[model samples]
Target: MEKHIHNTSLFSKSAALTLTAVNVILFFITEAFPSVRAYLSLNSVLIIHGRMYWQFISYMFVHGSLMHLLGNMLGLVFFGTAVERKLGTKQFLILYFSSGLASGALSFAVYAAAGMNHVFLLGASGAVYAVLLVFSVLFPRTLIYLWGLLPVPAPILVAVFALIEIFSQLFSVNSGIAHTTHLSGFAAAWLYVKIRMKKSPLALWKEAYRK
Candidate 1:
């Protein structure tokens, strides 16, 4: 079992930073060569008809815009570093890639079922959401600022995001946001914590608050 407590520097060399750098570099590469985006982005049609299964993993490294890349990388750098320190590099990568792949698989199933093969899903929002969820579970009491103001507990922030995603998915299906993928991230992370970590996220949050 991994210990709940860990000490590590945030800026130290880690998998999280490596991922951030890769995402940034790929963003620039894809920007210079737009055709690369089509190959990297997840599309149900491409995977089923063209046998481009690599998109499931590559989609996480490609972003639609600068803001998209910045948002995901910031979340990764912030929450991922802490999670990696607690879980160690190998376990952290497992959690990250597994959550991302699960999200992509679930999304592919949904898209194929609905016959929305033309939709292209890109970005690391899914994996980043999973990292954020793991971070909250590991540090429930940590304060996260909302828009540079209003300190909120990490768990509360995650709960709020979950609710927003559910609402958006149901009422705003055309919002151009992959709400399903984001929620899948949370679901995948929760299962990873329960089965691999042998812990309940809710129980950990409650325990932290009670202390």
Candidate 2:
């Protein structure tokens, strides 16, 4: 016998689509205005001294470059749809925004503590990474293509990224990428899956390994 899962989404629209649209619109907005990126991007100094709290949410919408925007949006669209469908709109929003906000907070703290108050971190990579982590955990056996070529299991792919981020954070590597935010997103996603789905990532990994 097979079990059929019925969706109980309050909204008919996809959360993934809404997120991608907002990000694309904001990217163009920053490009046209230019100055808006300063206001939208996460700046540790403004957040701490100037008290620009809203940047926490806005930073996720702005990307540094066209490639950066495309990469994050691609991840969101590919991984987010499945996660949103399983969690529904409300829960999906919770997971997405919460992870993004938490990543911003982590970035702010790390930069401020390091005396790098002028540092700015932008893009939806953190939130997208969180969504990817959750999707991989839930669909461990799902095949994911690396660089549109070699096939790798979703869980293993996500695990590789997680390990890379952990190493980068530990070594204080300056790769112009916010590795701490990536780790924070992974942490937030792990907690959400554990609490909401009552499934530990360890167990999920073991199950995947057995296969």
Candidate 1 C-alpha RMSD relative to the actual structure: 4.7
Q: TM-score for each prediction?
A: 0.93, 0.90
Model 1 spans with C-alpha error above 4 angstroms: 1-12
Judging by TM-score against the true structure, name the best candidate.
1
Q: On residues 110-204, what C-alpha lDDT tens digit does candidate 2 reach at each position?
A: 88888887688999988999999899887888899988899998988888998889888788776689998898899999998899868888787
TM-score, structure 2 vs. true: 0.90
Q: Model 1 over residues 55-169: C-alpha lDDT tens digits?
A: 9999999999999999999999999989999999999999999999999999999999999978999999999999999999988989999899999999999999999999999
Error of 2 at 146 (Å): 1.1
